[model samples]
Target: MTFKANWEKADKQYFLSAEIIEEMVRRAYTPKKLSSWSVIAGGCANLNIKINFEGNKLPSILRVYLRDKKSAYHEQKLGTLLKGTIALPETNYIGDYKGYRFAITSFIPGIPLRDLLLSHETYDMDSILFKVGGLLAKIATCPISKDLVRIPANSNGNSGFIRMAVPV
Candidate 1:
């Protein structure tokens, strides 16, 4: 099937049933009664559910890929790419379960940086950009693989991410 067709098909089947979540969990680890599963909002591209199973210490995030089936795999690769560059949720399980491409990842605590920054405190544009730049610097240095390394965007080029983080 084509990529566009696959994306549309996954979007139509967005709902992940409780039984299905349980089944996905079972494939990753020993199944336990799911204590709670709540949607984690504010994501731009995917469905994130903060789920807790009986006897688990920390919560796990169940992410359902909406745009593309390969999203889960790409994220798994990204986690590896950013392994030591910054703090990232460890992917516990990633698979295509019954046409639903998803991943169960270890929940990293704390609110998103966006929420933290946009709160009641008054932060000027430059301040936010500077702080965001620090984060970008870390990611900017992430290695794609042993043979290839990530190069910082030439501020002269059209990479907005580099420009936002570092004003030339």
Candidate 2:
């Protein structure tokens, strides 16, 4: 399904007007001309909106947290601070908010990993297993932690988001 269509399906519940978008643009103080805008992806957590500017350039992504939380903004701030250390998308805009926060960043171009994997007709089962093993091992050894992140405290465990369970 197209990103725009999927986004509409998920975010049509909370409709946002063009004037609100224009206000958001103004609040962001972005120089890019917003010729068009649409939702790219959305979920119970966030609505990822994509904006097409006047330059025929690539679209940018805006993440609006569904719940009232500043974790998204914190994540962006931390990413900016650690840009050189880690490959993080550049944050271009941040919107004005009274309760919920909104932020914009350069769209990270790529298919969702799930879509990419599913789109493949076939794969070497052994190789895929080995790659998954290697990836997990690398992640296990990685030294990332909440300390490196300036995001809001996830004081509320689970926070109504889905959690994955994998058998070891």
Ten-residue segment with the worst summed lDDT in candidate 1?
A: 1-10
lDDT of 1 by residue, 1-168 (tens): 112222222223256678887777677776567788888866656878998989888899988877777878777767765665678898888877887778899998987765655466665858867977997888875535433333455767744332222223
Off by over 4 Å in 1: 1-14, 114-128, 145-168
lDDT of 1 at 52: 93
Q: How high is each candidate's TM-score?
A: 0.68, 0.60
Against the reference, the lDDT scores of all candidates come to: 0.70, 0.61
Candidate 2 lDDT over residue span 25-44, tens digit each: 65785575788888764354
Model 2, which residues run further than 4 Å from truth? 1-12, 42-44, 81-87, 117-145, 149-168
